[model samples]
Target: MNDLERQSRILGVLTERPFASVRDLQIQVGVSGATIRRDIEKLHEAGRARKVYGGVAALDGLPPRAAALPFFENRDIAVAQKRDIARAAAAIVRDGSLIIVHGGSTCFQFGCEIAHRNVRVFTNSLPLAGYLGEHGTCQLTVGGGDLHREPGILYDTSGAGHTFYAAQFFVGALGISAEGLLEQHPLLVRFTAEMGRLANEIVVLVDSRKFTARPPTVTLPLSRIGRLITDSDLSDEHARMLEDEGVDYIIAPRGGEA
Candidate 1:
């Protein structure tokens, strides 16, 4: 297999287990020891895995590590659930209010739901901003920053210089464990955090699949979330966790009411 594909497999393995060595990874992926070492290096560089003595292990850092895959590929994994979550989140918006949206497939879907509304949108998501401009009457202010091609986000030093504000911020979680929300890139966190600061309320759109998974990094604490919208298939245990954290949440039925 190609290097990226092999590395994705390695990450899958590492995530399932714990730590592994170079020999362990080589055996699992059926690659040469040297090839395994190269893969480990690439994973470390991407902040997706950490190099251990023998091989490498998944790096589950605080939310917002550098994601190895591009957003398009990663986003397709749980699209239907995301769309459901987006529709529910969209139902909570009040017309004429200001909102901030981060960059991700789910957030893009959320943007789509609000496109025809008369609210204002401030964002660092390049793709979402572009989509909103096409169909939304909302005043769109694209956040200034370094554009990341993989995630289609404008980030870094862009929000630090601007003192813009919002009424609510809409974001999607890459993963959510008992620890909190996680994302794959530092830039994503940078912009998301800034958006959080600008908004009075924070709404997170996440599917049930993300409940147990741990992305490479963390984005925000569960306590910071004001509301969560998900699909009806989410587990009761996961729902309890949200309740325990005092996060108001709802799971809308597929193509049904929120």
Candidate 2:
């Protein structure tokens, strides 16, 4: 990985878990001890992380100020569910198809699951793009825009200069209710909606817990979503809701269950 990529990974690790040993960072980034140390030094110099005895820690007083949950914070929540959903989503992907994977923790897992597939992927998640650029065999394209550090997303406010399109668009949401797919931020709503328009099909990836969330902004209506892939834990009531909206749904089995 390049210096900028390494530094981003280091900072991402610190964001998820306050402290990380040099050894851990080395293993995760697949770099040498010397390289990890150099990246940590850069982060420390920038006042982004605290360089200590044998590792680095996130800055003490300044927590992320994002209105919505940051990528790191959402990454580990509903881990099993997210993995199962990703597996299901990956199963539906054709080997040579082109798709768009949007930013969010759940979609990040989906991106990783399909990293080695013989397909083309366009993504806006920095972490996902970085991971795929390093490990994926598929063609990868990142959207051009300013970065949203908290969500790890890149979005262009003016929505100009994008001529990309795909057969499918995979995305996650803050919540889903009768109204439609929901998000906590207006930019997310705008950008996600724009991406949906460029795709032939929209697939929603969310854990069952999101059914209970009631975020403020609606990104897309159920009518627009072509399909929904969620964990088996989803209640029959929500399944019926999707049915009522004429949306096809897939229930991904949990760990070890068939």
Compare the candidates by TM-score and give the number of the best one: 2
lDDT of 2 by residue, 145-223 (tens): 8998988989876759668679999999988988999888777788798889989999999988678667788899999
RMSD of 2: 10.4
TM-score, each model?
0.71, 0.73
Look at candidate 2 and give me any clashing residue pairs.
none
Best by lDDT: 2
Local distance difference test scores for all models? 0.77, 0.85
Give the residue spans of candidate 2 off by over 4 A: 1-67, 256-258
Clashes in predicted model 1 = 12
TM-score (C-alpha, index-matched) for candidate 1: 0.71
